[model samples]
Target: MTLEHKRPRLEIEYCTQCRWLPRATWMAQELLTTFEKELGEVARVPGTGGVFEVRLDGEGVWSRKSDAAFTDAAELKRLVRDRIAPDRTLGHSER
Candidate 1:
């Protein structure tokens, strides 16, 4: 018998403005904490508007987990509501 579980997931938008976005790091940390609570982990690649692969421990990440982690999406109304805007205000892929 096997107990199936959902994989942990997070999206990180690395800065493409040449300057670092500290908030992005904070976002990842917050996700790590959230996932950790569920006994899961994430796989991340460091790059501007980078994609992250998330899953349970031992289920190493794959390229498929990646997507558009950057850009100021109109869909991110919650992100805008939740945090202060960056001085740069440029999404990872903006450049």
Candidate 2:
């Protein structure tokens, strides 16, 4: 019955063979910090074949395979905010 359970959950799936855990972990930290109240939990899911995807409530918001690039912190924050807290301003991230 905590806010954590009520809010949405984010999942970052990264390729283990590609050594993307640090990148995924960093993104998770950024999201958890920015959307602390808006997000229920941020999970790091291990995968393979150079996969790096960000999912909110099981829906993908960003994918390296399709986007052809890793999402920057600001862009990731914006994408996440738009989905979970559209009205919330991301301060410097808005720039």
Candidate 3:
């Protein structure tokens, strides 16, 4: 007998860009695919949405990187709990 399970993961890809983005987008996809395959713990959860930006200037390179956090409702609440909860009192205005 056999069993299977799925783990959530970050899925970075070359989304649409302006008409002038370099060809590195395709190469970036290929390179990410190859690297992720070798690095097993890097999950590829489709639609586990996050934000990214890319600027390409060469066939095999990219620049202008940016990424933002991703969190569900529960996670978001937890992150802000210390800020909002009176008992925690680690608010941003703390000295």
| Cα TM-score per model | 0.34, 0.94, 0.21
**Please, what are the lDDT tens digits per residue for candidate 3 over residues 60-91?**
11122432432232332233333223254333
Q: TM-score-based ranking, best first?
A: 2, 1, 3
Q: State which candidate, 1 or 2, has the greater TM-score.
A: 2
Global Cα lDDT for candidate 1: 0.39
- For model 2, the stretches where C-alpha displacement exceeds 4 angstroms are 2-5
Q: What tens digits encode model 1's per-residue C-alpha lDDT throughout 4-93?
A: 655444444344454434644554565454335443443333555433332224342222234444423332323322332233233432
Cα lDDT, all candidates: 0.39, 0.92, 0.29
RMSD of each: 11.5, 1.9, 14.5
Q: Which ten residues in a row have the lowest lDDT in candidate 2?
A: 1-10
The per-prediction tally of clashing pairs is 0, 0, 0
Stretches off by above 4 angstroms in model 1 are 1-3, 49-95
Q: Candidate 1 versus the native: TM-score?
A: 0.34
Rank order (by lDDT, best first): 2, 1, 3
